[model samples]
Target chain A: MNVIVCVKQIPDPALPGALDGATNTLKRDGKLILDDSDAYGVEMALQLVDAAGGGEVSIISMAPNGETAGMRTALAMGAAKGILVSDPALQGSDALTTAKVLAAAAQRLGGADLIIAATESSDGYTGTVPEQMAEVLGLPSVTFAKKVKIDGGVLKADRQTEEGYDEVECALPALISVTAGVVEPRYPSFKGIMAAKSKPVEEVTASDLGVTPAGWAGAGQKVMLVAQAEARQAGEIVEDDGESFGKIVAFLENLKVI
Target chain B: MAINSVWVFAQVTNGAATTGTLELLTKARSLSPNVTAVLGGDASGVAAQLGEFGATKVYATGDLAGKLPGVAVAGAMKAIIDGGDKPDLILFPQNYEGRDVLARLSVKLNKSVLTNSIDVAVDGDSVNATTPIFGGNTLVTTTFTGEGPYLVAFRPKSFAAEASGGAPAAIAAASVPDLGATGGAKVTAVHVEESTGPKLDEANIVVSGGRGLGEADKYAMIEELAKLLKGAPGASRAIVDAGWVPYSYQVGQTGKVVKPSVYIAAGISGATQHMVGMKGAKNIIAINKDKEAPIFGIADLGIVGDVHKVLPKLIEALKGR
Candidate 1:
């Protein structure tokens, strides 16, 4: 069995002012780490390989050349090999174009028994790429899966639903999008970190996968405008005192709380 | 081209329709007179209700067992695309299932999709959508430049449901294709964690406790207040990390995002991540000892007092009501 996991490098959303002051876009400063949700996908892929007892796991990512750091981190997690589809022209491509590039890479890699990805990227939170990739690759896809298991060459998993959950079973050569609760991603061990340096990482250009700049990125969709984000104003704070407490009661009553 | 028709996916669960489905139909009705509501599952009775929400035609697709909603939605989208009469736009609710289906359908159609849209308007041969970003701290207006159907998923509870007051329309049963992998993955079993508080994501009112509660046991006070108002219980990342509450109850950038009718913060200092989750709430009330707590910045009402004393009083006031 062969498993392929698609990972993305995203900025840490916890930090403040990580936005580019000029473009009002997210600034990819600090360390570019593998998306937290994608880590679970990689972990699930590794688990599947382990369950099969001696299979291969490959990690693929489409990012700028500098994003090799994220691919290295995935390699350190236990993937057999890594592939980076990097080019300077791929910057600012929307989800549709990104899916096209990933689909092309998957085809070039000869496809896999199973493909996994994060439910959504933290930066854009679009949550569209994996499903789009499935569509482009002409494969069935499932999103927000909590647990995945394989049996008799068939893939069975539980995906989180709004009200409850739905059980889905698909044949091999499918795509699955996982969320955080699916599995606790493993931290790279000292041995794994050292071994990652020796692991083979293949670098391929977008053209190598038959992705044309005009069709893939140049014809990409564009957002005509982005409205400015408004800041909320401070509210009136009432001190806790006998008189103020009475006023608070009155306020709640006016708001129909009391 | 003159706008002719619009389609909205009406989500149904346990024989009942969701509010977001009705809201989508209402919005779609504003765009074109030939509005259709597509519903899946054994919930075909919802087709008539779609007419009350201004759907001129209700397309009822019966349930396909073991098929996940993603497959069903994609099939429905294909039906609209191949149904001989094409629609100008397709609308879906921005819930978990809707988001998943729209993402897949957009890819299948090779079209651009706008999720979590707050508003939609039609211009000459184009449509504009508005959505909040950076956790509702900022809003962005975007438009697509393609000629295909523009897919949009609107946020739940964002639009008010309007009455159509018309007779039921003729229901059209759409043939749901047996696209393999409806249930792409099967669940052998399910184990739900025992929980008492309201689900933070689905709650209309939320009362959150923070580290200012001082001790893990003191959370009982916050829970007590939440119960009185029949609201959901939430916590800041600090308290969750400290083991006072489960991570599922945490409200922040890393946690659940809720836009309830009213949000109450008790003893929280209001970190940016925490604020981003609940900032879209209609009304915000904060109770903290420090007057300068950042939670007060976005709060509509603030009380400077010890949570230990304030929470109990608030409960009493709610009980008195």
Candidate 2:
């Protein structure tokens, strides 16, 4: 079972992220890391490949300035190879355009039996690209997956819902967005890190994938304004003087929630 | 470019229209007098409710049974749109089903979607959507620059769901086109987590525990407090990621956005992502040992204490009452 995981290289979310004043988009000129969310997908893909006995796991990512630092992390985690779709024209692409570019790159890889991705990226947080990719590829998608198991060419997933979870089953050549914490991602060992440095990572452009005029030129949406949100006023602050619980109870009583 | 018509992708759970759908309907009605509800499941039961929220028409597909709603629902809406329906905008809630349908529909229509919106304003052919960034510290207003049938997904509780006391909406049957292999997913079973008190999002009071509680077992204090107050237990993403609680119990930007009457956060040191979820609460009470935790910035009452001592005392005090 060949699996292709769509990974995202994002500005380290731990640090502050700033938007470009000119483009009204998040600045991406800094060093990027593999989104922590996508690690669950990559780990799950590796496990699925292992379970299937013998298949390769490939990583596909779109980043600016030929960024492969994020892809190198995924490759170290046991993915066979990597494909990075980078282009100056792909700077301001929206999610739909992203789906198109990534979808095109996946097709260029001659497709896989299954594709996996995080339910959403930490930086973008659009949470729609996996399904959009599935749509562009005309494949079935099962999202918000908490648990996944493969049996007899069918994929079964415990899909998370508001109330609980739904047991969903889909055919092969499909896409699934796995939720975080579903699996424990392993840290790359020294040997694996050394191997990842030599792993073949093919870099391509929008024209190479036939998604020319990508980014803002192909985007259907534009940011009109960016402003400070109305700040929530800070109320009273009290050091716990041992009777703090009484204060809490009194506050609840005032709200009539007690 | 005037929004001649607006459509809401309605969702139904437990045989009734969801509150999020009604909220969207309420907002859609305000934006355009001509409001249509596009439902994926049977609309027979909720047609009147849809109308009460100002949806004049409900274009629905027959029962989906257990099939995944994305392919069939998007296909049904595509059929309606292709059959001469000219809605300028389609609104969706940022929920599971809504996101699924909106994503597929964006691809089907070759359009883009703006999601996690808190507000939308109609401006003569342009619909500006306001979305929070950096965890509600800043807001960005985006507008559709493309063709019609704009798709936007709003977070739940973005608007109130008020009924207009209108007649039952007229229902129009829409067919799901042959999906071939694209509609191959099926739901084989459903497992609802057993809950003893109010749901986390629906509760009037939410008591969430975080990593400062020290260990997983201490989460019981949160449940105890929530139960004593007749509310629901919640968790910070840290604890949820640490496997102390289910992801469903998480309250954060990536989890459930909750706006309870009173939200008591224990041990959670207000990350921007966590703050985005509960900042809308009418009353915020935070308890953490660190006095400078960012959570204190927006907290209505910040208790500079440890959850270990504070939660127990609070639970005991509430029980005594």
Candidate 3:
């Protein structure tokens, strides 16, 4: 019941984000932090492994500058170790390329009953990499899982849909993408943080996994131009004056929604 | 290299073509007269309707038999393409099933994909896609530099779905190929959450609440007001992430993208991500106490007020009417 969770170390999303002028991709050279979205996956994996009673959770991430700060956060939260794939050639890689690298790294780790990831990263938000990784690894994928459970070597997931939810099932050696709020992520304890500083984190390159990254040059897709989106004009602003609700009623009446 | 055929991954719900599928079909027809619909479920029920929307042929897998449609459908399309019946372009909706199929297909074909696009343009032999990034504040134009068939996933409501009044499309049988270990996942059961009123995405009017509502109990005001207006209640990512509501009620970049006739944001100081989902509404009304809230930038009418005071009064006024 060894579980591997895919985590992403991204630039802090609280501040404004900028695109690199040279590569036309989001600038990533800044200090990276753990994407809040991936915390759910790490938490879910930890709980599942704990429930299974005899397994370990490992973190796998691909970030530039050999970033380990984000991975260390997950390690402090109780993951056994981590594998970081960082290489200059990996910059500007598309979603599929990232999927290939991650899938190859998962195979390199080997012997995992399950692999988990966030439905999408907060910064990049491609929302396609997990399923693509499933395709590349030739594994079954159950995405948008709000609830997951293990029963007799089978994985049962409550997959969120537009209407409601579908109970999906698959065997081991599968990938699952979890939605946010699926589980509560625990804060790293002081003892855990001290232990994480000495934990093992293997650093590798894309080539180390036998992956030739289809970077911006080979991805077959290019960002031609980036421009500001059209701005919508501001309308009237009125003080509440204890009667602002009347204006809304009049506005909706004008639109016939009343 | 010449544009000739365009294919759409037509999604069906309740034995009928989805509105998103019809929108893709309409856009595909404009790109090429030879529009084909690739349906994973029983296409017999919606083949004619697909044709009326401009599909000349429907390459359909009769039934998936409970297997995950993404694996089998992607396998079937890969087989069809391997059989040398490839189209120049393919369109899919940026949704669960669509993303699943397109991602699998991209890996199977070793092709690239452009997703979350809001518009597509044709220039000579190339197709360009426009995607809004940074929470719809910035637009990025992208195009494939490799061979066809190019894959692109567009957001729902990106285009208007209009029927061309054409004849029934010819149905072609497409069998799901052997999926190996990837076909292990299956839907065991479905549980539809009990929800009242119109769907958030399809409703003519939408009322959304945010963190300004103070706590979970106050969300009832949003629901009550929405009910009085005969609309759907929505929530910002903040509230949804805080466990105040289900993700289905979320309206944001990572959630549902809704384009309603009138959108009301109460106690919502709009984050750019939240604005991305509801900016397309024909009319936007923002009710927040903070006059400098970013949501007022695009709001059709900005009311400076408190939700606790204003929401109750608004609900009373609407109920009286």
Ranking by lDDT: 3, 2, 1
Q: Which number leads on lDDT? A: 3
lDDT for each residue of candidate 2 in B1-321, tens digit (9 for 90 to 100): 778899999988888899899999999989988999999878899999999999999999988878788888999999988999879999999988889999999999999889999999988768899999998988999988868888999998999999988788999998999888889899999898888888888999899999999999999999888989898999988888788999999998889889999999999999887988999999999999999999999999999998898888888898887
The prediction achieving the highest DockQ against the true structure is 2
Candidate 3: Cα lDDT at B149:
85
The sequence of per-residue lDDT tens digits that candidate 1 reaches over residues A122-231 is: 77776678888887887877777767998899888877665555676777789998866576678999999899999987888878888764432343244556666778
Local accuracy by lDDT, each model: 0.75, 0.91, 0.92
Write down the TM-score of model 3's second chain: 0.97
Tens digits of per-residue lDDT for model 3, A104-192? 88988884899999989988888999999999999998999999999999999999987899999998889999999999899999998
- The C-alpha interface RMSD of every prediction is 4.1, 1.2, 1.2
Residue lDDT tens for model 3, B1-321: 567999999888887899999999999998889999999977788989999999999999987887887788899999999999999889999999999999999999998888989998788767789999887989999978878888999999999999999888899999998888999999999888889899999999999999999999999999999999899999998899889999999998888898999999999998877998999999999999999998999999999999999889989998897
- What's the CA error at residue B106 for candidate 1, in Å? 1.8
How accurately is candidate 3 docked according to DockQ? Answer: 0.81
* Candidate 1, position A86, lDDT: 83
Model 1 chain A lDDT-worst window of ten: A213-222
Task: Show model 1 residue runs off by greater than 4 Å.
Answer: A17-26, A29-31, A214-220, A237-254, B178-204, B209-222, B235-259, B266-277, B287-294, B302-321
